[model samples]
Target: MTETVQRPTLEAVAARAGVSRATVSRVVNGGDGVREPLVERVRRAVEELGYVPNQAARSLVTKRHDAIAVVVAEPETRVFADPFFALQLRGISKELTAHDNQLVLLLTEGRDDHARVGRYLAGGHVDGALVFSLHLDDPLPGLIQRAGVPTVFGGRPGWSDGTSGVVYVDSDNRGGAREAVRHLVGLGRTRIAHITGALDQTSAVDRLDGFRDVMADVDPRLIAEGDFTPAGGERAMRELLDRCPGLDAVFAANDLTAAGALRVLREHGRRVPEDVAVVGFDDMLPVAEQTDPPLTTVRQDIEEMGRLMARLLLRGLDRLHPDEGHDPAVGAPASVVTPTTLVRRASA
Candidate 1:
């Protein structure tokens, strides 16, 4: 014989608390406009009865799924390969979990996937979204905006024209790039070169701009295009060395890129920080610290950026539904640009 345990219900809680069903409902929903004493009474009753409010029934009353969709415009391979995405997701997951909200990940691989994601967002499956990995020509942002869901972007989006009220969290990419370049200059590396990440990404574009900010009127031959990957870095480094064999330093857009460049440098019989001083952005510990001679790079709080994005999105949601346990004290959500630091290592 099998036995099924019955779950405690709102009616049982109301009966135990000596309150009406309506009172219990009010308290259970959000406790908004409910007196503290009564709320405490209901809560105590709930605890005593082990009453678990049915999320499905609650959603019907509150019209909120209490779930958030995290849309990443990258394939599974790229998402899994990069530690940056994992750290960001961890931050987002922690924040959302603390708020009793569910996270639904939506990954896109191609144009067809984008359409499918757009449709899902339009279907009202979740309360809001946290979107990441946007490219300059990416149409996902536009689709999300059209879907009218509250969203917080993980990085600065590359819209052709600045759209008002677009919320995002990003590191100071340009500033970080400038610091890396200036550090190389301080080392008296006159023939400095740059290996850029994919130009399609705003982060890469901003970093490249930062390099030029310091190296104004730099030789065009010293710049090599990279894809923010070790393989891309390897290819770009070879191109830079071939084009300007006399270059004394290299500023790669990211740590992975720098690692690749370092490998190529060693292959060419150039000693790092001696023959060619190297600098990289994104002090990703696994890549930066593990590199030969380690790596001097710009450090951005990737996990913190993720947490901020979720916080901003949730705050925005609260603003929209002020009566639903929304705290008035929390300020309006705005775009945030977290600062970056240049972490010094032996490589530079």
Candidate 2:
């Protein structure tokens, strides 16, 4: 025995505001050509009557779902375990909410999942997408492009089809790595070793390129491959120690890897910053601050990067739907590479 409160309709709002139904529809959608007085009148009527537009009905006229898809080409385990994605999602959510848009998160695990994601994007279920494709060989970039949905990438995409432009937001990975290695060099550590992330990933490759930029003549034995995980860090560190026991420094690709290196270093009775100096990237606070002697790392604004991704996607969408109040004078959205800064701590 429940009495349901009726929702106000477009007709009710128009009658209350002494305007026609078409006029109310125009005002409620965006008020592009309507006079200010009529817009204000309709607004007052809507506020008083608690009128909410029917999204399904409105979409028919405007051709927008007011929803955005955030597609991550990663397994659920990695997405949940990494703080980087969480912080980035928070920033994206904040920006999307400010604009009254909905977020639909899509995670892909395997080829089957990639096919499903491609269909979802191509189905016209959402207005646009924000994608994260980490590896150079990941087929997601091509899949999404073929879907023909406007997309803004979380990181610089590795694959190029040459038929379309790619828009992305990313940190200065190469420059950050260079800064880290240079800092260790400033400490006068000659026998410097590096623990690189997975070479398949663009971020890892760029960071490795940056390291070589500084240590051009470094011994081949001083480099070890890591997977941007604590376990990978441990294995690489042990290998580096075994191959070059005289190494005076280690530059880990990320904070998680740095933490693992610290553990292995401790196990081997190596005193950090005394016997060897260490530096990391990402400045992930939980790992960076709690590590033994803390970690000197590069700080990239992860949350800001996420926010920028959403903003870029929305702006691009606005450009497509100029009737939704997009300014023609505003230029098309372009790729952005945010700067990275070196955060010094006790580890180095």
C-alpha TM-scores of all predictions: 0.90, 0.91
lDDT tens string, model 1, 72-103? 99843644676889899999998888788899
Clashes of 1: 0
1-348 per-residue lDDT for model 2 (tens digits):
899778889999999999999999899878989999999999999999999988888778778888999999884364467699999999999989878899999988877899999999999888999999888888987899889999999888887432348889989999999999999999998999999998887888889889999999999999999988999999999999999999999999998999999999999999998999999999999889999999999999999999999988999887334565645687778888899999999989
* Window of ten residues with lowest summed lDDT in model 1: 319-328
Pairs of colliding residues, candidate 1: none
lDDT of each: 0.90, 0.90
RMSD of each: 3.2, 3.0
- For model 1, the local distance difference test gives 0.90
Q: After superposition, how far is residue 234 of candidate 2 from its true place, in Å?
A: 0.7
As for candidate 2, its clashing pairs are none
Worst 10 residues of 2 by lDDT: 319-328
Q: lDDT value for candidate 2?
A: 0.90
